[model samples]
Target: MSSRDPSLSPTLRLRARGALANETGRFETERREAFDDGWDLPEEERLLRTEVRIERPRSALTYNRSPDLPFDRSVNPYRGCEHGCIYCFARPSHAYLNLSPGLDFETRLIARPGIAAVLERELRARSYRAAPIALGTNTDPYQPIEATHRLMREILEVLAAFRHPVAITTKGTLIERDLDLLAPMAAEGLLRVGLSVTTLDPNLSRRLEPRAPSPARRLQTIRRLAEAGVPVRAMIAPVIPGLTDSELDRLLAATAGAGAVAASWIVLRLPREVAPLLRAWAEEHYPDRAAKMLARIREIHGGRDYDPAFGKRMRGEGIWADLIARRFRLAAARHGLDRAQPPLRSDLFRPPPRPGDQLSLL
Candidate 1:
């Protein structure tokens, strides 16, 4: 059987593609159906191919007032993430486009090629105030498709030209390709990167985040970025309760060994449609632990699958949450990864020259 064939595994037999099912979006007024003939198809024929659609949005920057987040402004060059992570909190966002939060969220992606120009215009606005704009905040800017479209690179060039500060969070090793630009930005204290490392076990990583870089590759990425003078932080994001949480110390130590100067973590969050997807994934891949894992999750969230309240969202609320936090603190401190890094400098920002503007006569 082909590697992508879900029928090969008992847990994956339910999913023809990456997700368990192609659920209809909440806003979709219409529904569709598919029928499989008796004839068996080849693995290649059954494989789901990704489709990229171009989008020209009027604005590129997304502003949010959530207290749980560190930054107020973010840029998402892509609409949907190709990394088919089962626990992705951003899955619900696909509903806005009348697409399924399941398989469609990974296969049907939207690329904004004109985002760089829009960002430039916004940055050049007279009322604009300079601040560190976050990248990979909504969807990864360095997903697999980014290598072909290069929209993220174009956005980086715009930020580089204007000397705008940027903070990037991603799981793709593709960021290593832009060291030439990022290294210089790092020298000026305008760039910081966070590499999210979910688990150390290759099998678990593959089952949870199918398309993301391997744990080893991510560690190498952290090393390369740190060597390039870029501030690197290891993000142990969406720490699953009974599944991957036990490896917290090992993950932190590994990251620190890879030259990550700081660390952070967020407890697993299952908001909206993500809850059902994760529960299904857990039941399929880890049937033995599914009940216990889900019970622990609810325990942390106070009898609910998730608590959307800002303060309790990122780091749940309960004894289990406190235990995880305490463990992370000890591990981080042991590795000397508790040092606070300086914030990205926005003072170097300079508006890009507009069309028809006079050249400076220096």
Candidate 2:
């Protein structure tokens, strides 16, 4: 990567990151940008290193009543996913922490080491009701940093001990490492996993997701999980228009052949700060088709970059959106993956016993 290169060229220097700029977030007191001081002195090109801060927890589960979502509760073990997918809808969340949704959203991470304990306590509450808690909703729970932090593992342990149900969505192959814990829960219908496979093309995957696992690797993960008796859903998430739209049928066939029991799709969404970042990335990477690709997105979102309406958010309305949906449905049906993954069972939930607790003489 050359320092003299254009400011928006991330690959020319920053390597695998997806953001085109390191602009400050919206909540910052002031905006800051670098400028040449006219000194021709040599300077080292500092590569952005991932910085992780420990977040002590006050609460573990975040509850929402969004009609658009399937689950009402979720727990994000980490903030600012390192996967660095340029089109991540979660990018704007970094701004609430006074961090940039650009590079900062990928390089600067927050790990919650104490969330498991907090979650255990919360689940033990008298008012608590059993429901499948979602993971990797905002940020991938099994992101690269999870390898060392192991917070996800700890949380899984708590859930397993309590026989609690969990639904996980991720593109990380590291999930294979937790088979020991997951296999048993899977036997009891307490878990399901959604593996996002954006595109079947490896080169396009690297440019779009950067640090995320290759598309083939995600399919392999789905196979492994399915073989383990765990329910697996192949998610063709944020399906980029013009770029990946043509590959939808191939994706369904591949994932179905790889043992994906169900398939789902979400159109590319560029909400908040994610819009400009994706536009810049497109300009830097796919200069020729960038405009056409963006135009397709506009057609899906009613002539705008995005439409956040509840029913319209996940799958936009329009001819283009309908075409993609129709294609997915037809392909999925042909591949025997027309149905959605079944919800995990919550009836088996039982809180773990605490010291000094009364013994049940069942």
Candidate 3:
């Protein structure tokens, strides 16, 4: 009798997840494989389940020296995303935690409890300098689990109390729930939002980002945020050369119609495990165009699946990259999104008074 591991073969029924396999991380010394013992296990067992662990953060701000990044510091309240986008470049980061960058990256998550308190202490430090602290830089801060954890709201409360500047990027519609905090911060020039709209077609979005919000839903989110007076920038990230690249102009038009004030785009990036993961996903989902799609992706990346070079990693290199850049510039200009999002104000920052501090009456 022949046997197979059910989870090894994902099906359309898994509407809540992505990733074709739970491949072992590169750092793992011993590999693991599932075995069918012929006991006829129930099919419901095949469904993947998400698990969350709490971490007490010793530090709130993670500073990066990456030359290409717009911000130097970011705060990630959660690690391991629930929205399992098959092509996520952040997947490989899970390997650092001794976890697989595949299915495990989405199934296993970490929530930082009491992180807002830690952040408040850090901001209150006399040596601490004020800058726009970015959220959702490494992992989405507003993932579904956040609705229960309420960490994002607590952090925002701290920032609001201190009058600190912040910039957040996300695809989660749950951000709308915090308009009470966001609207006033934006009015003071202390906030901006990046709503990632990878594709306008819901079908492609379903396969590409199974657990993330739909393309239409994201457009509505942009409109909602804009109506609240918050600056919303449409982010057209990872334009898949053969798949969603053609939608660039249409995407800008749609976002503009939804009231976005600015726009940006980045070509597909397949670093580390992402290269193979996306290849397998493409073959499974788009067998007819997988080869051509991958070929063009490599062409843009200087004949490699990915080039980690700081200057070239995000936007890529060569003729195709130039062409995409030109198209984005033209589309952005036509849509009145040629400008960058307004810079957040740091001058408004004032640390909240701590307990036991001397009070003065004037």
What is the C-alpha local distance difference test score of each model?
A: 0.89, 0.90, 0.89
Model 1, 190-225: lDDT tens digits are: 999999999999989988989888999999999999
* Each prediction's number of clashing residue pairs: 0, 2, 0
**Candidate order, TM-score descending:** 2, 3, 1
lDDT of 2 by residue, 1-362 (tens): 22222443332257699887877788899977566668967776666788999989999999999999999999999999999999999999999999999988999999999999999999999999999999999999999999999999999999999999999999999999999999999899999888999999999999999999998888888889989898888889988999998998899999988898898999999999998888888888888898999999989999999999998888988899999999989999999989866668899999977899898999
RMSD of each: 3.6, 2.2, 2.7
TM-score of each: 0.92, 0.96, 0.94
lDDT of 1 at 88: 88
Q: Please, what's the RMSD in Å of model 2?
A: 2.2
- Write the residue-wise lDDT of candidate 3 on 267-357 in tens digits: 8989899888888788888888999999999999999999989999899988888999999999999999999667899999998667897
**Which residue runs of candidate 1 sit more than 4 Å off their true CA positions?**
1-18, 35-45, 354-356, 359-362
Q: What is the lDDT of residue 313 in candidate 1?
A: 91
